[model samples]
Target chain A: EPEVTQTPSHQVTQMGQEVILRCVPISNHLYFYWYRQILGQKVEFLVSFYNNEISEKSEIFDDQFSVERPDGSNFTLKIRSTKLEDSAMYFCANPEGVGYGYTFGSGTRLTVV
Target chain B: AQTVTQSQPEMSVQEAETVTLSCTYDTSESNYYLFWYKQPPSRQMILVIRQEAYKQQNATENRFSVNFQKAAKSFSLKISDSQLGDTAMYFCAFMRPSGTYKYIFGTGTRLKVLA
Candidate 1:
């Protein structure tokens, strides 16, 4: 089965440093999303992208965060300056089809010191 | 706005037994989708099953089945003949049929299938 691929399985960075998490969604998928789960907390939606632009974003997706479909297959999420609270497991996902289901990547664990 | 709630934080079932995880949501829109996702210790999100709000028939996949009550706004997952591998955190999610396709997930129910 085709799966979403996310780079940097685990990352550790200083609180003020920048980090870029990358994902390659399923080739035929039209929608892409970023979700984060703080330890012991529910997974929260950060942003959704389509047609080369952000379709919607949650309150957690603030100025410090940004997402890009830099190219045909690569979708990336960048954090300008990480905060200690930013530590979480970030997952990239895309729907199998319109409301059919969603396939999620293994997730990039971001740890900010 | 949509909110999914999984009231049970943790549950355990003996191997080969049946277990059900409960989920409820609040949504005014009649058209939407409900889902149950599994997250093991590896922390990978896996789609288990899905139900379209308009469909009254529940969805089932092998040993995984769901009891979807549209009137009560409830969607519950039932795992039959549970195996040790079934141990994981189960999340119930909600999504609007149109617009951004953003998903709202519940806090999750941690299920342990004991050997």
Candidate 2:
């Protein structure tokens, strides 16, 4: 089965540095998303991308965060400045289409020190 | 807003026994979708099963099935003949039925299969 793939399975960055997490969604998938889970918190939605634009985003998705589908296959999430609280597991998911269940990638564990 | 709650933070089951993880949600929309996802030690999110709120009949996938209660706004997962490999963190998710956006995930329930 085809799967969503994320690069840099684990990343370590300084508090003020920028980090960009990358994801390659399933080739035929139309919708993509980024979600983060704090050590013991719920998985929260960051943003959803479709047609090269942000379709939806949650309150947690603030000025510090931004998502871009630079090309047809690559989706990226960039954090301007990392904070200690930014440490968490970031998952990238893709659904066949809208309203369908999403297939999640292994996840990239971001450690902001 | 829609929210998913998994009250049980942790659960354990004998290797050969059956186990059920509880999940409840609050949603105003009449039509939507519910899902069960598993995350093993590898941290890979895997789809366990799914149900359409409009469908009254329960949805089952092999030993993994769901008891979807539309009236009570509850969707629980039942794992039968549980095995050691079944140990993982289980998450119940809610989504829009029209295929519009991302999902709302529960805090998650960690399941351990004892040998």
Candidate 3:
């Protein structure tokens, strides 16, 4: 099974500061997704990326959030201005295409102070 | 839009015993997939089992299996001979077969396997 690696297993940042969460996808996989789980809550879809562009996104993915595959290897989620409520565990996932399961990163736990 | 519902917030079973977690989803699409993902304390999403809507046979993986009732819109996971390592949060998810294939996850059921 292919693995997706997430950086900074844990991060603590001040409210209103910009934060970038990075995910390293498998070299051959083209579709990727970002999801966040607030403490004690269900995991929510943030956005999906395909072929170096945004394919779709949920209402939770506001203008404050942006995703890109800079350099075509590392996929990143950037929060323009983090709020206290933005603290959660963010996971990056890669689907093995149709009829297959998805591989998810261990997750990055973001803590806002 | 598709929605997954995990009615149980928590459950527990003695080691070597059996336990079942409940899940229900709402979707109009005829072709889709349902999945059960295990997230241990480590918080890594591990695929436990998956069921295709078109398949009548229940999906099973070792000690884990699902009773998928398509007409009832219900999918439940049954764990046999549960072990301490089985303690974790179980999430039910729904996904369409095409397009972005984004996952809609339920709130999750925290299971505790006792000694």
Task: Give model 1's docking category.
Answer: high
Candidates, ranked, lDDT: 1, 3, 2
Give a tens-digit lDDT track for model 2, residues B12-42. 9999899999999998999888999898888
B96 Cα displacement, candidate 1 (Å) = 0.8
Best by DockQ: 1
Least lDDT summed over 10 consecutive residues: which range in candidate 1 chain A?
A: A67-76
lDDT by candidate, in order shown: 0.94, 0.89, 0.93
Candidate 2 lDDT tens digits, A60-111: 8889999987886799999999999999999998885555578888899999
| Model 3 spans > 4 angstroms off | none
Q: Which number leads on lDDT?
A: 1
Better candidate number, 1 or 2, judged by TM-score = 1
TM-score of 1: 0.98
Which digits, one per residue and each the tens of the lDDT, describe model 1 over residues A1-113? 98899999999999999999999999967688999999889999999888777888999999999987778779889999999999999999988888887899999999999
| Candidate 3 local distance difference test against the native | 0.93
Ranking by TM-score: 3, 1, 2
